[model samples]
Target: MLKRVEKAQQKWGGSHTVIDNWLNERQELIVLYCKIAGFSPYEKKDQSLPEPSQIQAFCQILMDYLSAGHFEVYDDIAKACEKKGLESQQLANTIYPRISDTTDIALDFNDKYAEVDAEDLLVGFDNDLSVMGEALEARFALEDELIDNLYSNHAD
Candidate 1:
């Protein structure tokens, strides 16, 4: 996941302030995810789920990242595509539904994690995180394609 994020940064870095900041936020979310999922290089010695505060913090960042992508980034890109004419608009229309699928997966994760007690999460947390990781990976790929397709001809 971290590797995917790095690859994205390299591909899209310095493209625009909006994209750069979005990528940075993505990296932050990935680091927090790795730490919580016990896959980080600096993984804590303990095996149990992290403290509620830690998970809550991750959830907060997750929600913010999701919100920004949907509200700000996608809106701006869609409008740009509209202006760029039908080819861009068609590509965006095709991609947006797929992206929204990933968004729903992420929102489900956020809803489950952000609302529950730590003790309540113990039964399915690992599975949930695994699914979240996979969804995020798919999301990153789709988002990269969106940026490439929409912004490659010209940076905004």
Candidate 2:
């Protein structure tokens, strides 16, 4: 029993670290988003749409975040659940489709606007940004649910 608990800790400890890093990345993304969207310190009066390069940078980060979740984090959670002999299929079924839907929206947003020059962004870009923001907000909530349902249970 001690060995089993130690192994579970070993498995979950690494995932907990990864989840912490991912959460930090999410915070950074949120700040960058607010900067580009002209909230708080980047007030509307002094704000302009971020440069094309900036958007590209954010898109790269966004892609990294998404990739890490799918390729690393989710796999780790599934493995941990399997190790514990817990049934996570229902959780996966509920969350995976929502996450996939969000991924499609994010990719579409990145493709459409990541390359647009600052000048082009001045014309009707707000609408697209608004949609992206909403999608991201929903996505983040869904992701938090996943963590709570899956990772929190395994936390040492």
Count of clashes, each model: 0, 0
The candidate scoring highest on TM-score is 1
> Per-residue lDDT of 1-156 in model 2, one digit per residue for the tens?
123223334444466788767766666677777767777776677456677876777787878888888898788766765665445556766777888888998898788877777667356667877877887877877766666667666455
Per-residue CA lDDT of model 1 for 1-156, tens digit only, reads 778789878987886788789889999999988878878585777677877776777888988899989988899889888988888889889988998898898888888778667557467888988998898888888888888887677455
- Taking all chains together, the TM-score of candidate 2 against the true structure is 0.79
Candidate 2 Cα outliers beyond 4 Å, as residue runs: 1-15, 84-87, 119-122, 154-156
Candidate 2 residue 81 Cα shift, in angstroms, is 3.1
Off by over 4 Å in 1: 44-46, 154-156
For candidate 1, give the lDDT of residue 107: 84
lDDT of each: 0.83, 0.70
Error of 2 at 38 (Å): 0.5
lDDT of 1 at 31: 91
Q: Look at candidate 2 and tell me the lDDT of residue 151.
A: 60
- Which 10-residue window in model 1 sums to the lowest lDDT? 114-123
